[model samples]
Target: MAERLHDPWLVAVWPGMGTVAMGAGYYLMAKLGMHLWEELPARDLFEVDHVDVKDGLIQTAPLPRSRLFLWKDPNEKHDLIVFIGEAQPPAKSAQICHQLIDLVRPLGVTRVFTFAAMATGLRPGEHGRVFGAAIDRGTLDRFRDLDLTVLEGGQINGLNGVLLGVAAESGMQGGCLLGEMPQLFSQLPYPKASLAVLEFFATLAGIKIDLTELESHAQDVEDKLETFLSRIEQAIHQVEGAGESAIPALDADEEDEKKKPKLSAEDRQHLEQLFTEAKADRARAYFLKQELDRLKVFRDFEDRFLDLFKK
Candidate 1:
């Protein structure tokens, strides 16, 4: 059963782990009870991810779950709690967040902050990035020291996104700490992404965590990934030199192939036009929403001023 979360001063976190041991050590410390507080759950995050449930396949969706860790300071008043994970939900990404609100609201939490990484397409020889956003002005102000930039066109499409929405709906303050990572590293869990996420988390949590172990683990993973890439490149080079495969043609248009008993030029043009229109329409709709939001804010201010002087 889902825990009835009370109103907690909850901290939501979702760091990539297990795929490689990069950020695993930070999680490990929390596991070893070496920190200021002990994890309330008898189980760890990974176990929670792999726990089995087979009830005739009525429904079996993995993830969209969170790990709850709680610690109480004997002399302090409120419990310090952290929630970690991505919830399973649609682009509206909300289901798991509802569960978190249940757990924290009952516990007296009124704030929810999530952690994530912003990925980027980087050259193999270039550096990475770290960025963030917040749902509350105060939360945004607090993390300003992390050198966080304003996310102007920000929208959440993942679990972290949903949690932020939960915070918004519940009138709770929320924020996200993100690390910019390479797109090439997107295929699997990237250690660089893990490092960026944890370091950023440490800054906000005010929790002193020694990342030395995590760093060592990240180095090992990085070496392995680099080796894998080198092998793949070498294999591709060998295949190309053998001449079994021809280079992809950039000029093979429908007009050239139409008379050869294939698709007509008109059909190909129609398909391309359909795809182009779909992409343009999606982009236009997104911009329209932004414009509407900006206009609404201005209108709200104007309405307030009009009422201010009214008898």
Candidate 2:
């Protein structure tokens, strides 16, 4: 049975560059104290491409899930529904989006929003600008009123953008908010971007949620990434100062391997401890992700790292 909602608006999210969309979605769900509403059946849309191996044993991994959570407004202005997809379908994303809208539309949802990350040349120390694209004139005007940079062109890859297109086709009003992230650190989790997107959304939606924790986390990550970038800059300067013959000539593969930092045993232990802390408090997961990225081992722990927000 569907719980009766009050003029609900839908916000859908999926994992993407810098974990921006997923991070914001999870934070919203946590802060709003939203409860799981329903899980969209998507077995036919997603496939298990691989199994997990732990302690030398192969374990069957479950298919990705798409879930919706509901939060009722205390002031009765409007309700909120957050849809978190564990992973985007490899194909037919538009079809699944149609199914999602069909489920929520009956509950009085008329507006949909999606969050994503936009890779730019901006440095980590710089604030991530919120970019927006709306499906209609009124929504675009709303975005302009919020002082967001309107996305004039270019594509928003994956379901974050595709879902909004489907919503527009359904005659619903919606838009996408894309937070700017450093292109060089696209593989890393940038909480600053997540914070920017949420800040804009909260204001636009006339909702109040404490952003102090996310603000602090964003600053922490920005400082770390800035420092890391400085080190790389220094290394580059030193290399450039040296004459061509002063540096050894190496193949592209070897150069890439040489540039990567080797993680020490102590670093691994620290990462394990951080992961444990993150498991206990999901807010700390970004910190764990930062450490993994610094050590260039995020890919190795990506699945388990993302699992921290599965609930």
Candidate 3:
């Protein structure tokens, strides 16, 4: 026998800064806002107790090898699937998702969702627009009010594209909530966007996300990111400008400048410290670098993600 698996119909999340906000929000609600967010504290609404994460690739198709969590509604038997993993897409993440779906849905999982974000030119001051797309039109119509500027945004590359396609194939209900964080949000946390996504998810799940911790973290992440972007912008200006083709046109002359990262001891230590924060998601961290190495544009912005969770 397959040992009679558990936690089907779970609410899955991937490990990233977004997951941090989602998990933090869930934690705050379960711990302090229980009176308002859920009818049951531990088992019904937030099921962190059910998380199972592996060290390596858990899925190989279109999804990340997600660490799984099962959120159940106490008053009712209804549940949501949460997978927390460092996501890539349509390569390994899909496989992990399919495995999870096969294991859980037979038990009664009717819907699934994955939390992620997109790097955009939009800044936090711009209401942190939350974009959502569903596996089906019905789901799209459902989230029309959350303020998505790009109904076509989900068409972009990576896990966002594949997961939705898989959801459609599996005959399961699925949706993705993508928050617009400034392009600089990559390689660092972005709290404003994270909070916006959580609030949007809470509305869908019919629960309120406790935003106290998220608000605090958002302030910190925002400050650091603000500084980082200023530097990047300044660097851009000193060299040229932040235009599409203005990055000094990395030609032969620039090729020589592309050596190892030049850093002071303090900067090296800080980089190491950043890696430590992602200890649970080493694969993602490694792959991110590899992808960065392969990127043609600014050595690729895709891998510079500020992923902060086991996702």
TM-score of 3: 0.55
For residue 120, give model 3's deviation from the true position in Å: 1.4
Candidate 1 lDDT over residue span 1-311, tens digit each: 13333333566655342222223322422322322222223222223334444565544334433345564434344345665443233332354567667666766677676655566665333455556678788888876766665566756556667778777888888676666655655545555655666676656655555565456645665666566556657667767664424323222221232234334577447444543442444222222222222233312232222121112
Which of the predicted structures, 2 or 3, would earn the higher lDDT when compared with the native? 2
What lDDT would each prediction earn against the true structure? 0.49, 0.83, 0.50
Q: In model 3, which range of ten residues has the least summed lDDT?
A: 33-42
Query: Which sections of candidate 1 miss by over 4 Å?
Result: 1-9, 13-66, 73-79, 84-95, 123-126, 230-311
Clash count of each predicted structure: 23, 0, 33
User: Candidate 3, which segments miss by more than 4 Å at Cα?
Assistant: 1-10, 15-66, 86-93, 146-150, 153-156, 227-311
On a 0 to 100 scale, what is the lDDT of residue 237 in model 3?
74
Candidates ranked by TM-score, best first? 2, 3, 1
Candidate 2 similarity to native, TM-score: 0.79
Off by over 4 Å in 2: 241-311
What's model 2's lDDT at 175?
A: 94
TM per prediction: 0.55, 0.79, 0.55
| lDDT assessment of candidate 1 | 0.49
lDDT of 1 at 97: 63
